[model samples]
Target: MKRVDVAYVLLVDEHEENVLLVKNKGPGASYYTLPGGAVERGETLEEAAIREVKEETGLDVQLGGIFSVGEAFFEERGHHTIFFTFTGKIIGGEINISLPEEIEEVTWMNLQQAEPYIHISNEFEGAIDSKTTVPYMLRDAGRYRS
Candidate 1:
């Protein structure tokens, strides 16, 4: 079975007090997630991360090291998905839902405050609950295979 590659960006405030999250469009309007999507053909992972953020959040980002990873297998669909969440910082543009069809709103909140709002997946369990967030908490180099 072929695997799908997806990229996600975690943008935090410079003061390290807040994290930028995008309110996803679709069921549970209250739920939030990072700005990202599946990698497009011919686009490198880093390029995809930057593009996804700009497309979904209307913000330019400078992606940092890999922050965390999540994997899921859809047996019914006969496909597997690997999620690569990366740390990033806003470098340009302002808050806006570039693609309202895919996003609802853009907002920022500290990790603790974001915990309840985020229901992305079980793999992201301790991301906000951990006291060791930021400062390279889960950062590592990302390897891209073509």
Candidate 2:
């Protein structure tokens, strides 16, 4: 399987009561996720995170500590993906979707109201609540492959 590296961020408000999320335009438009994407070649994890957030949500962010590192292998896609998530603070720029076709909406939500839309990390259940969320990473992902 081809290896893919993905980077994401958890952008929290100064009060820590809200989060910035994006609703993708395609199949999963209904569900909301943190603003981030895949890491490009030669780009550092932090660079990718900053670039993705700008592209997806039009926000400039100041990244904090590494929040988590994980891997997910998808047999169907023939992909082994390594993901990294970091805590980020919005430094500037207005919130908007640069790629309308790929991203439908960008909005800030009350942490309490975002629970249902956020995908929680199972391995880190304690860290997977509404107030703090990491993208859902698959487990034993490619086991079905023969």
Candidate 3:
């Protein structure tokens, strides 16, 4: 199986009561997910997170540290994808679905209201539940030493 790296961002509004989500345009169009996508060749995980948010949601954001990591294996596609999720702040740019082919709409929803549409698999299951207080699935998935 081929390995793929993807980055996602959780952008909370000023009140911290709402989260930014994007509705995809294709088959799973009814579902909503955090703004993010596949990391491009030679792009850092941080760069990809920022870029995907901008491209998918038309929002310019500055990412905080990566908060969680999840893995998924697609047997049919032979893809083993590792997902890196980060917390981010909106620095500029307005909400718009720049990439219509990939995204249908972008909106903010409270944790409870957003819960049903947000689905996750594998290691991401517990971290992102609106039933609790914290919204983003924040976990210490790595450590660095020099």
lDDT score of residue 45 within candidate 3: 83
Per-residue lDDT tens digits of candidate 1, residues 1-146? 77999888888787777888888877554568888889988677788999999998889998777776678898987879998877888889987777877787888888777755444456657665343323323334464443
Clashing pairs in 3: none
TM-score of 1: 0.75
Please, what is the whole-model Cα lDDT of each candidate in the order they appear? Answer: 0.76, 0.77, 0.77
| Model 3 TM-score relative to the real fold | 0.78
Q: Provide the TM-score for each candidate, comma-separated.
A: 0.75, 0.78, 0.78
lDDT of 1: 0.76
Tell me how candidate 2 scores on lDDT. 0.77
Model 3, global lDDT:
0.77
Q: Write the per-residue lDDT of candidate 3 for residues 31-123, one digit (tens) a residue.
A: 688899899886778878999998988789987766567788999889999988787899999888777777778999996576554445445
The CA root-mean-square deviation of candidate 2, after full C-alpha superposition on the true structure, stands at: 8.4
What ranges in model 2 sit over 4 Å off?
28-30, 112-118, 126-146
lDDT of 2 at 19: 77
